[model samples]
Target chain A: MKRVKFGTSAAVLAFLAASPALAASDVCKGSDINILMETVPDTDALQAVKGDFEKEYGAKVNIEAVNYSLMHEKLVPSLTASTSSYDVLIVDSYWVGEFKTAGWIKDLDALIARDKVDTSLYFPALMALNGTVQGKTYMLPFWQYAMGILYRKDIVDDPAFQAAYKEQFKRDWRMPATLEEFAEVVKWAGKYKDMYGIAMAAQRADPVVMEATNYLFAEGGDFYDRTTWKPTMDTPEAAKAVTVYADLINSAAQPGALGANFDDVANTLKQGKAIFAISYLFLFPTLEDPKDSTVVGKMGFAPVPGKDSFLGAWGWAVPSNAKNPDCSWEFLKWVESKDVAYKRALAGGQPTQMWIYNDPEFIKKWPAMSQVGTALEHSKGLPIMSRSTQLVETFAEVMGSVLANNVPPATALADSQDKFGRLVKGDPLLK
Target chain B: MTTATIRAGSPGRRRNLAQYVFVAPAVIVLALVVAAPLLYSIYLSFQEYIITYGMGDFAGFANYLAVLSDDFAHVSWVTLKLTLLCVVFEFVIAFGLALLLNQPHLPGRSFYLIVLMIPVLMTPVAVALMFRLMFNPSLGIVNWVIGLLGIPPQGWFGDPSLALGTVVFVDVWHETSLMLLMLYAGLKAMPGEPVEAARIDGASRLQILRYVTWPLMKPVIMVTLMIRMIAALKSYDLIYMLTQGGPGKATETISFYAYRLGFRFLDIGQAAAVSFILLIVVTLLTLVLLRTMREN
Candidate 1:
């Protein structure tokens, strides 16, 4: 080890101090690590950063990216096998509950403490919701997502429409802040020739469930009672949520809302058709894309009008059977660090840090930072449970019945209860 | 020399040994690929097999009992209807087109046949997505063309009442080509002498088609029907890419239901039980077809 004395050598030391990944490379040794992630912007950003990390710590990284739908199929065999294939795994937040119960993940609290990593730098709510399972930090927060109401600011900002809106509703025209106001906007804007009130995924699939969950929570309803491990989707408020979801889909949303996903909703906004939509934060970047969007610099986002919006985020965890656990931690620490996360955010990745949300630099770049912060604070992540995945699908079918057919919301929810009850029967997990 | 001295058995034994030698590799491959998973599935059907938890509790007959429900009935009925509907329409259209192409001295027949058979070349997922975009109520070409006659924009797959039918239409669009190729080939192989003789004896085209052509086309139609029915029963890609058995399970067939159970629900035991039921249904269908052939 050599000591540098001032000036030119000091300049090199200052640059090294700026990059946490480069500085931390000396603390840990290197080996080969295979990482698993869904094919999303997070995967792209990680791949882009792979070269830098490999050079910093002499580790070869093999990244396996799969479509989101097939992630479970790809992960199950690897996790259940006697030997782990992937050293690092990115887990959808909902699966964290069961993963924790299975004891297939390494507890990272000691690692963070030893490395003196400041975990509080990340969003507190998401860190609590996604990373902590059973009061233990098993995963590090990566890309965070929250449901929001993205609106056509250009259209709403027009004086003609604003005057007409005020005359019709006896109030100022603005983005909706509550479910009633959301429905009213849907009805009010639906009569226009060019714009629909909202864009939604109301079909008989996963999209409907994702959209409806926000409504369920906004109305102060929930899917399960944690103490009893029982479903609660058939409650009066839940039933009302279903009805509202259906009514909005039928009268206020875009014509193809039935089978449309978030991509479609964002695309509709980009094409200058829809006035508003409730979707994840990833939709924001596409709206800013110059080549694809017709509504560039013309859209805005707000916290969805509800008690709370829906939240989803994926995080990196070291499999208990990791072949190179130390190298995996080194890569994970580098990716989740302040400098790398900031860089990743600039390159089409959603940053997970609390400072990134409040930073003056990012707030200037991101138009909806304040509203995003509010949404994150109010948002609720999907339930962490043994059968959480199926519960989502089951509720979707129930809600689909409400929207697609003329099934009464109450009846459809009851039918859903029946179906889910059959699933929960004789389950060891629930017991 | 030692092999020759080993056992000179009867001709029956020698023939049996020869048969075993020829069939052993195929049997071994089948056991490894097909029979192994099937046997494991049967074993798994009796246990609560969570992928995360490995093999869990053994609840005999519980999985089988759990799988028997109204959901199963609804899915099976949807499968039955879709299979029957697609097979009927595909056969009728394919047979009609085959007859038209089978005409004497048709110009550019090869070119027409090649053009008509394009759908089967593309993947089912691609075909389903193409139709999904085509039927998009906002900007689909379908509504644009139909709007010329003042028809309102139809929901197509989004309408619970019309979703299954719309799905069948997509399936027909992509799959009718297969039926046509098969039927056309069969038409060429059929004897023309009977039809020629009937025409010379003053029988009309309709009469010749009904009596002469119908009898000869039965076997071909049956084979085509079997192929189409089996394919329809196992249909997943189009439904997954289009409606996902949605708009309220209108297009939810047994195969999709079983997949949702296994993959989505993580109910491996119940999923295996559902698959076993489908296997039985297919076996019964095959038996009935074979019996019909024997009787006919």
Candidate 2:
């Protein structure tokens, strides 16, 4: 084993030495530009774009594919070192404030203006998510997803279940209209012997934060008051919202839901163990694909039932220290363009362009894409804040505590409020 | 006559120089790798360092103050409790196993030693993950087996009250093997003269174990306890995989807390501060243990 490891290391060194010379002569001009991208499931679609990008620009794009969690860790150290290891980065939407406030991302508003890029083609909600403090675009949408309810059509379509759902909610049983109605349906569906009524991404980290925030926002609770910079999540409505969610999970969600994340929830739905699930539009193609799912044609999508507001889509952004800002901006525009974006949608990549939802080819490829469009139409981005990361983290802890029944919702939110206030006042940059 | 005396000393000096040359590489490697990083971390512990993707800042002593005042005090207390509990449990179990294995004419002693060492040899992450699956409330083998015994399924890691204990159980499973191995070796090497003397003196089996065997094994036990305590205090991977310090921070340890502060929150300054504090506590405990061992 040691001998093999040594031989492999030597081979790698040799390859590394030879590749630079070969790359300089063939694909790139001047210096090789490294693009650090968050790993997405659709690698094939990205490779196609990479081929075209290299051919058009005469610049080599070194794609450093990293897991989302590690990407964040790597970003911080690289940024601190001021090492141009990554010319472009795909960051989470919530990270925009941290990156922008730190001046770690390049302002792309001027670049967008220079390119005469048409913003009308892009989803407005997705576009809004990329804007920084001064309404400057730091990133553009590469792919877009909105939170929606995924349900088993076979169960929801059953004659008796449909009649009961419609009678209870005063609707066609197609989609839930309010948070209360959603909880009722979940409880109603959970009574079945073979399936869980609902499954959510409750696993620790960002997934839990995302789901928890959706409910918090839906209940008209803000992480912090915009004017006073005080957290308002400890309100009665917020507690009510949290309790509603907790009750649903406690009574209707699958057992062992505490450790389940996006992948686990998706698997549960795909395996037909879950009657319904809350997830992003990205799950649509996979869940609808006959090859990948047992319930391919049996799954359906709906907008997340909202009490007062809906959550928006997640998009992409570029860092401020990009070496090849021009090329990266061009790539962003091309990717978000109607034609290219629609092509990507057809190939099972979610499109951030508004026109793709209307495109016949895209709709035919995956019918559930329309539900994403509907969700996006009504969605609202998270309340903008300088201390968004702290808010999200504290909120997750609060919500998780409530769900675990370790603390009442009101107390959890109160603790979060105190912590958020401390963080804001403590950090001079944020203030 | 003086020149001949100088020539006679030259070979001895050359031999000393050869010894230094042979040891130089190892010293150089240690300085370059271990010592450098340790010193760098100490330096960073004093600064409020932010490693943003493109920019960073340093604030002196702020990181330390934050960690000292942060919510991590509770987490630190919890970690200390967990470390003590796990270590105590491991020692008792391992020492008992060692005593049993030390008996003459014990059946398949070698086979038992191999079987017992397997848990210690397994990777902590793999073991944690396996236990996680086994403890799954819905489909886990543990729950299934319990059902057969007419017992209700318990939320092992899911329940906030049980999460820490569950992780502790997993840690005990993985770590007892190390203690067993160490104690076994210690037991095997124990002098038999003390036992023979105790027997001649008409000491009961328990009395001999307590008065003679234990007294002689004191140094070994102390050293093993110190080593195991240090290892337990630094426990991160197993807990991380098992609960991720979740169910409302019920299972959050100091090391996991530091990681969350550093990586998850991107509050490197606070993380550095917590780590330094942890270092101070560990160092003090280690010194006390060492002094006790010396006295023994």
Judge candidate 2 against the unseen true structure and give its global Cα lDDT, from 0 to 1: 0.73
**Chain A TM-score, structure 2:** 0.85
lDDT per residue (tens digit) for residues B1-296 in model 2: 99987865798877988899999999999999988877777777776555433224566787777777876777877798889889999999999999999999999999998999999899997998799889876658998898999996676886777888888899999999999988888888988888999899999989998999899888889889998888778778987788777776778888988888887777666777787778888888799788978897
**Model 2 TM-score relative to the real fold:** 0.83
Where does model 1 exceed 4 Å of error?
Answer: A1-40, A57-67, A82-87, A192-194, A227-230, A321-323, A418-431, B1-15, B292-296
Model 2 Cα displacement at A102 (Å)? 1.8
CAPRI level of candidate 1:
acceptable
TM per model? 0.90, 0.83
lDDT, candidates in the order shown: 0.79, 0.73
Model 1 Cα shift for residue A253 (angstroms): 1.0
Model 1 lDDT, residue B17, Cα: 93
